[model samples]
Target: MAEGICCEFLKGLQKIKIAEELISLGKIACDIIIISLISQFKSIISMLFLGHLGDIELAGGSLSAGVANITGYSIVKGLAMGMEPICSQAYGAQELTVFRKIYKKTLRLVLVACFLISLLWLNIEPVFLLLGQNQAIISVAKVYITYSIPELIAQAYLNPLRIFMRTQNITKPLTISVTCAMIFHFPISYILAVYFNLGVRGVALASACNTVITILGSLTHLYLSRTAVRPWDRQAIDMRLEDWKPLLSLMVPSVFSVCLEWWWYEIMILLCGQLSDPQASVSAMGILMQTTALLYVFPFSLNQGLSTLVGQALGAEQPARAQRTAIMGIGVATVCGLLCFAFTIVVKNVWGKLYTGELEVLALTSAALPIVGICELGNSPQTASCGILTGSARPRIGACINFVSFYLVGLPVAVFMAFRLDMGFLGFWYGLAAAQASCACMMICIVVWTDWNHQAERARGLTQTTEEQASLLS
Candidate 1:
């Protein structure tokens, strides 16, 4: 009878533990979404400002932003993600020194990368011309790209800093920092773009200023916050070429994985530019993309939070816990996706008016948004699986799957539907929906078949190496 009572107590304790974990995940996911939404709104504000200027500014801004995102921002962000597993696992192992070293090195690498990307941006005009973009919009795009330089530089620092804090489960500071920056974003953008009549350049500058504010705010918070981890060491900030091997191993695959997905979206925008009534098509897509960005924040937050959770779980030698976290992330993502679908459908016909009063653009956006909403259905689970891959330190698998799905399967369907079938801009979205569904299906299978214990062991090895390396360096 006493043994039976003890078992009952144990079961109750287990239930409480599960409840606690669910609550913790919910809190982290909420914090991350709040911060992400604020950050995304900065860009949306820019788009809104530019869209109000005219279709030329809207098309040009969207095109330029798409190019910048695909060629520069996505790459930098992907490389920074290489630090996710490292920092999360190191924090889990309580190896602050290793975490600091990886963070510092990643910052340096991305700075150099940003420099190279800026060079490309500097001479982006000729490249756009070569791509056969509308010449009128191309010239406008040049001005927008030029002003975006400072933001690019700021992002190089901001991405790593954000990841560093995220790994340590310190999210409220990021939320506060981004919120402060977001508060400044709209007023600053309004002054420069509308009040001063600076046009797209003003919008770009406002975005840069907002990013700078976010970076500074985050840094200040990190310095003041007394987390379990100690302050970052000044001595640990140097770049070590030997360390590049491990980071690059992850970074290269990560770059391809993220870039492949982002680049496909950009390519879709470019394809829209090639359609009849190019300006209207591009503007409609720009508005739709902005709307989609809002829905994306939740799933992306899950990706970040779950990646850290799974990484930490694996680092702590809890394979089952890591697997459970991945499953929970997918479940949460699915629910978010369904909710977004309903919201998107409800707002599709009206949201375009928020960007522009152009009847054609609004009509096109209304029709296209529902399709984008359909894509979201697949996007949530696919993105969740991506987070699992990141945490498992198997980014190559994600990269390979992305290439096969987007390049091999998705792109052809988009081209065929848009051009051959003469579905025009709508065809591109249909292809996008198909691609997302296929990618999600593939990723779900992989996650289910993943060897959780092996993933945990891999995380163990990664953290263990840092210990040995620190001993040697010391």
Candidate 2:
């Protein structure tokens, strides 16, 4: 009788342990997901304002935004991600100074990157013209891109700060900051764009103002919270140009991997601009992009959390734990993908109405929803797998896979379908789906066969080198 009781107690304890792990993961994941949603909402609000202006403005804004994402934001964001492996592992390894140094270095690098991207934005007009976009869209796009400059600079800083907080498991502050920023966005946008009559440029200024608020909020929270993360050491802010070499080594592949996938989507948008009815096609593509970006917050948050989790586990020298984190992340992402697929399908007919009311835009957007929704099913898992790779310090593999899947295979099929077969926007989306499917399959295989123990060793080596270099410089 006593033995039976002891066995039952052990079983209960095991269940509790499992439950605790899941809860911990869920809590962090959910907070980051909320933050991501709020960030996406900022874009949606801007689009809503633009959509209301006119179809031409909507198309122009969408194209310029797409171009900006590919040329500027994506590169900055990807380079900042180089900090993920560094900071997460440093936190796990209890190397606080190392984390601070890397953070400072990353900040400097991204600032320089912002300056370079600004140059690109300055000369964006000719690029649009050469690409054969409508002259009216080109003109409006130039103004929109011009006003969006501040927002671009703000993001260059915001992304690195967000990653810094995430590595320390300090997410609630980020969530709160972003929420406050988003809440402030709507009224500010209405006042500037409508009441003040600044038009599209007003909308852009409002967005920049909101981002500044978000930055201030996040900085204030971080400075005030004594228990959340470690304090900054003033000494670590030295101009450590040497540190960037190793970081950039990881960053180059990381940038390419992220840019390839992002640029592919932008290519789709550009292709839509080339369709017979440019206005309707571009408007539909814009709506679909906004919708997917909203739904994408889930998997993307999963990616961020999983990267931190796996990086920490590996840094702590627990290969098995890292492997398990990867598996659990995949499970969560798959479920999110399935749920998104179902919801998008149910809302397909009415989804367009949320963005626009034009008969042509509504019809085209509704038709594209199914394809976009189905793409989400594959995209979620693929995105999770990419997160795993980021954590494992193997971004080069991801870069190679993305290039091959998206460019070598998917691009050709998309072009053939959209242009040759006359499938138009539907065919463009189908090509995206195919790319997602292929990337997911390859990434899944890579994750399954990954040697987590080896990755841990690699992480240790990377951190050890950073520590050594820091000591030498000091």
Candidate 3:
């Protein structure tokens, strides 16, 4: 009896150890998932609310989102991408002076960009009209555009602060910030749109309000960074043209290339709305898209975690370790992708049914499910590869690869297969299979050709090469 008890105790201890490991992993997966989910949740809210306004409004919202989301997300996330590598490397080397300087400049950049965005909002109606959208849509979209504009500034500041914490793996606060924002934004948006009958303009205002609230909270969280802050230099001034060149060089290509990807998505929505069943297509796809986007949190989070670890590791001159970390992240993402795959394949129709009872919409989404799942499988590896490259500060290559894979190759082929053949919504989604598949193939190629073994060495050389090009500024 004592022997049995002893054996049971040992088994319990083993289980505890296993549980700890899983918990550690869960934290990473959770952080990224939260980041992606919270960021995209506003869109989900807008979609759900707008979905109720009949198919025309639903179609308009999706088109607006596709155009608006691509514009907003690509620009904001593009700039935000700059924050991760810069902070990771700076923090890795314990360079607080540089970090502060970078922060200041980045903040200035963000503020300036936001002002420009505000002006754009003022003139967005004519711009939409010029783009050949319906007159009514052009009118409605202006309000949403105005609301989205103010949020950009908030996101600019918020991105740096959130990413700064992310480098330190302090994601709980960011998560809370997003949660609180949603809390404030959702009911408020609902009240404005439904109760007050403010319509789409209310959505714009609610989103802007949400951004301000979240940004303030995120800024407050940064106080902790000062406490955890290592002993470092002061005089938060740097004429370090060298420091920024690397960041900008890496960022530009990525920004330009993704423009195409964004265009394809935005344009697809535009085209989808012109379809025979615009309302059904938009409502059904909108729900499914949000579901897929939410599920995307895990893989996207894995990508962020891998980038953080790998970038820091590369900064610390441990390229082999970084490579292994990337592999592990991919492995984890692949597993999660499989789960999402099953969810979409086996239970997507179930999800569609739960979200709405419309037989027509359900039928469309059901037809699209198989293609969507397949897209995830291809997208997971490619998505994770984005982090792998960003860690190396070699974003241009990834960007170019994605551009070719998605636009030059993916978009044209997809459109032909879908529209030319009248494959309908299913055809449209099937095209992504080609795009994502090509992207996956290209990203894999880029990763393999890049020297994971000497990533740290490459980083050091990048610093040197950057210095050689110009004098450091003050």
Candidate 4:
């Protein structure tokens, strides 16, 4: 009877542990989702104000934004991600000095990159002219991008700071900062765009202003919060050549992984313009892409949350807990995917109405929405597994897997089915579904087969200082 009671108690304890983890994951994910939504809403507000100026303003602004995303923002975001594993692990291991060093190093690297990107932005007109763009549109794009350089500089600070705070599970400050910025974004944008009559240039400057506000707010909170306090080590601040090697090693592959995936979507949009009915096909594709992005928010949030939890667990030398977190994260991703699938199906007939009134676009969207739903079943798990890989400091592996799945397998299938076999636009989505399925399967296998104990050892090696390791050994 005593033994039976002990077993029951152990089972109950396990149940409680699982519940606690779920709650923690949910809280982190929710905060991240809120931040993402607010950011997206800010973009919408900018677009709306630009649209009010005229279609030319809207088209030019939109074109500039796309170019900025492809060239500047994506690369900066990926580079910032390189610090995730190090920061998460350092915080987990309670190596506050290491964490601070990584943050400073990443911020410097990103700022340098922003400088190069600004040069490119300044000379973008010749490139756009070479691509056969309209002279008027290119002229407007030049103005918009030129004024947007400050925003890139702001991102250099914001991106690294966000990753640093996130790894430490300090998200509330970020949320509050973004919220305050958003509240001011509209009025500031209006004053500049309309009150000052600066057109798109004013709008771009307003965006820069918004980011500055967010940065100031976040920094203010960090300064006041005792939990986030980390005094900079004078020696660590003076980084040597070797100090940058580890970060670059992780940063390069991460850039490739993120850029490869992002470029694929842009390529798809370009391909749609080549279709027989270019207007309708491109319109439908745009609607579908927007739908996909909206569905992605939750899975992406889960990805970030899981990355932190797994890195923290491994850093703390709890291999078993890290493994458990990986499993539970995948399970949660599956449920989220199912819900996304259901949402697409239920809204299929009516969803396109939100974006457009054309019957042809609506019909195409209705048919393709289910395919997108199917894709989510795989995308959710793939995204979650990426987080696990990131936490384990094995992003190179994920990059390789993404290249094979998206470019090698998915792209050819899309071209062949869409053109060779006459599948049209639907064929494009079918190809995406295939890629997501293959990517998910491969990533899930990798996560399940990971040796958590080995990863913990790696975390120790990564997070500990030379002195700390040597002392521990002695």
Candidate 5:
């Protein structure tokens, strides 16, 4: 009888732990969505501002932004991707020294990359050539992006800053950070874009201003952290090429994984530019991409939160707990997918007015959005799986999965359907749906296959030489 009673108590304790985990994931999901939407809402409005200037303005802005983003991802984020996992582990291990050094090096690298990219964009002529723009459109996009430079500098450093805090399960700061930045961004964008007749350039400047504000806010918060690994820990890092092994290993895969995935979307925009009546499809797609990004934002937030949580759990040597956390996060993400799916079904056409005056583009984008929504349902799960892998510190596995799923299968199938099949943009989007569904299945399979508990045990004992982990890693 005593043994039976003890078993009942143990079961009840497990039930409570599961409930607590579910609650935490739900809160993190909501927090991520709110902050992501607020910041992205600024860009969505910028797309509208450019769209009003004429489709050329919209297309130019979208095109340049896409190019710049992909380029930045490849160089900056890719190099910095190793920071999150290492930081997550250090943060969990309570090793302030390694955490501080890694970030100091990363932030320096990020700032340098930002300066170089800003110089490249401001020069304007080469950018125009690279984008294949005629003189007039190039001049406009140059103004827009040049004004947006400070923001990119600020944005470029964001991964390291956010990832550092994320390692400790700190998520509230991003919401506050974006909120403060927008306070400066929107009003300035309004003043420059509308009040001063600065046109696209004004919108660009406002975005830069937002970045400055965000970086300042984030830095201030870091200054206040209990961890001494805050922004000022420069002395902790050796700052030599030889000392970079720990950070670089993790960052390389991270940068590739996200860049490759987002590049596929940007390429879709470039391809639309080649279509006959390029204005209709490109404008429609630009609007649809902005609209769909709002939905994607929620998933991104959940993914980031999960990545941090999983990393910490693994750091703490609790594999089963990490599994439980990942499962709960995915479940919450699915519920979000259902709501987004409903929104697409119900409000598909409502947002097009925010972008274009053309009735035809508006109608076309509405039809395409529902399709994008379908893909998003699958995207949410796949993204969470990505977080699970990252948290497991297995970015290469995620990287391999992304390469096969997106490049090998997703893009090829999408291109075939979009042009060869003559489905136009709709075919492209439908192909994405098929690809996302397949990828989600693969990710789910990977999650089950990975031995998280064993990984947690290994991750706990950071005694292995960096070369040793490299050998074991995929």
Candidate 6:
């Protein structure tokens, strides 16, 4: 009877522990989702301001922004993600020195990359001219890109800082900083665009100003917070070329993984222009893409939170905890996927109305929403598994899986169905659904098969001091 009672108590304790994990994950995910929404809102505000300027300004700004995302922002963001494992693991291991070195290294790498990308931004006019773009559009794009250089530089600092804080579970400061910056964005944008009449140039400047404000706010918070890592700590200043190899190894694959997926969406947009009813199809596609992006915030938030939790667990030498976290994250992501599926189906008919009044666009969007829903079912888990892989320091696997699923499998299916099968716009979405499903399946399999104990050992190596690693190697 005593033994039976003890077993019951242990089970109850385990249940409480599971509940605690869920609460922690939910809190972190909520903060991340809020941050993402605010960032999206800022972009919307910038676009709205651009639209007020003129049709030319709006079109040019949109075009420039897309190009910048594909070439500049995506790469920087991907590179910055390399810091996740290092920072999170080091923080968990209580190795503050390694964490600081990785942060500085990542920041420097991003800045160098931005400098190179800015050169490309500067020469966009010539490139667009070469591609036979309209002279007027090229002129506007030139101005928009030129003035957006400051924003690029700001991202270089902001991305690293975000990762640095997030790994340590210091999310409130980030949320507060971004919120304060967003509040200032509207007035700053108005004064620069309307009051000064700088037009698109002013709008770009305002965006940069707000981003700088966010960076400053984050730094100030870090400085003041006793629990947070000191951004200005002098002891964490050591750097060496040899120390950079591990970061680069992770960063390059991460770039490919991110860019491949991002570029695929852009490619789909290009494909829409080739459809028979290009105008309606492109418009509908745009609306559906926006819907997908908005819904994606939930899964992506889980992705971020899971990566941090798993990394911390492994770094602290708790393989079982890491495995459990991965499982819980996948389960949560599955629920999110189901919710997204229901949402798309329920809103299918009226969703397009929010974006357009055209009957043709509305009809196309309604038909496509179901397939997009199916894609989300796959995307949520696939994304969560990506976090698992990232936390385990195996981003190359994700990159390879993405390439095969999207380009090799999905692309051919899309072309055959759309052009040859005469399915048109719907065919494109069906192809995406196929890719997402396959990707998710493969990712989940890999995650389930992961050697958590091995990953814990790897984390130890990653967070080790140079001498410690060298001794181990020898």
Backbone collision tally, model 1: 0
Task: State in Å the error of residue 73, model 4.
Answer: 0.3
lDDT of 2 by residue, 1-474 (tens): 999999999899866755765676787789988888777788889999999888988888877887888888899888988878878887888777777777888888889999988998988988898778889999889999989999989988898888888888888888888899899999999999999998899989999999888889888988888765643666745455665666776678889988998888778877887889888998888788878888988898888888888888888898877887888889888999999999888999999998788999998988888888889988999999998898877788889999988998789889999899999878888888888899999999999999888778777766766565344222
Better of 3 and 4 by TM-score: 4
Model 3, 127: alpha-carbon shift in Å? 2.5
Report the Cα lDDT for candidate 3. Answer: 0.70
Give the true-structure RMSD of model 5: 3.0
Compared with the true structure, the alpha-carbon lDDT of candidate 2 equals: 0.84
lDDT of 4 at 122: 96
Please give the range of 10 consecutive residues that has the lowest summed lDDT in model 5: 462-471
lDDT of the candidates, in the order given:
0.84, 0.84, 0.70, 0.90, 0.76, 0.89
Worst 10 residues of 6 by lDDT: 465-474
Q: Write the per-residue lDDT of candidate 1 for residues 1-474, one digit (tens) a residue.
A: 999999999899877866766776777789998887777777778888998999999989988987898888999999999888878877877767877888888888899999999999999988898777888999899999999998899889889998888888888878888898899999999898889989888899999889889888878877776664533677744345555666767888999998998888778877887898899998898778777777888888788888888888887888888887888788888888898888889998789888899999988988888898899999999998899889777788889989988988889999999999999989988888888899999998999998898776677667656444333222
Root-mean-square deviation of Cα positions for candidate 3 versus the true structure, in angstroms: 5.8
Weakest ten-residue segment in model 1 by summed lDDT = 465-474
Positional deviation of residue 225's Cα in model 2 after best superposition, in angstroms: 1.5
The digit string of per-residue lDDT tens for model 6 on 1-474 reads 999999999999878978888988988899999999999899999999999999989988988988889989999999999888888888888898888888988988999999999999998887667646687878898999889999999999999999899998988888999999999999999999999989999999998998999899999988878888875556554567566678887899999999999999988888988989999988998899889989999999999999899999988999988998999999999999999999999999999999889999999999999899999999999999999888877888999999999999888888889999999999999889989999999999999999899889888988886654433223
Model 2 vs. true fold: TM = 0.89
lDDT tens per residue, model 5, 118-228: 788778678578777787777777776776676677667776777776676566776788887777776787788889988888777777777677777777877887743
What residue pairs clash in candidate 5, if any at all? Answer: 78-255, 81-251, 82-250, 82-251
Error of 6 at 367 (Å): 0.6
